[model samples]
Target: RVRAYVPYGKQWYPYFMRRLAERPANVAFLLRNLLRS
Candidate 1:
């Protein structure tokens, strides 16, 4: 699972997490900005 990978000791895990974590926020932010524009 993605959640499990985020906690384990892996080189790329944290990178994936940041990307994954920010993705939804970014999408929501974009949609709101798009509607305003």
Candidate 2:
């Protein structure tokens, strides 16, 4: 289901974008935690 993924307001856009751009690192961090369990 490919739909337009526009963010609602400008308030959280910057923070969300930054996290999205760093998704690889974020995933790695999560996976590391998962493996630690």
Candidate 3:
């Protein structure tokens, strides 16, 4: 399980993108949970 706190603002997208880029596994984890819901 992974958790994060991202302030909602103009910088949010870039911040999330950087995180996803840093770890491709994050993308897979996200998709897995999203589809499970």
Candidate 4:
């Protein structure tokens, strides 16, 4: 349900904020990927 909603690299702060809010459970894992880009 969540992976479908993740933002691609081109998306910036707003995208990160939205996804984080939408899935706090995955914040750490998602943040790791975000930083890797």
CA RMSD of all predictions? 8.8, 9.4, 2.9, 5.6
Provide the global lDDT of candidate 2 against the true structure. 0.73
Best TM-score among the predictions, by candidate number: 3
Model 4, backbone clash pairs (residues 3+ apart or across chains), number:
0
- Please tell me which model should have the higher TM-score, number 2 or number 4: 4
TM-scores for every predicted model:
0.38, 0.38, 0.77, 0.39
**Cα shift from native, residue 33, model 3 (Å):** 0.3
Model 3: how far is 22 from its true place, Å?
Answer: 0.1
Residue pairs with backbone overlap in model 1: none
TM-score of model 1 relative to the true fold? 0.38
lDDT of 3 by residue, 1-37 (tens): 9997866888988898888999999999999999999
Which tens-of-lDDT digit does each residue in 1-37 have in candidate 2?
7896566666677876677577778767867999999
By summed lDDT, which 10 consecutive residues of candidate 3 come out lowest?
4-13
Candidate 3: regions farther than 4 A off: 1-4
The segments of candidate 2 whose C-alpha lies over 4 angstroms from its true place after superposition are: 1-22
List, residue by residue over 1-37, the lDDT tens digit for candidate 1: 3554234456577775577587788767757999998
Whole-model lDDT per candidate? 0.68, 0.73, 0.91, 0.76
Better of 2 and 3 by lDDT: 3
The global Cα lDDT (0 to 1) of model 3 is 0.91
lDDT of 1: 0.68
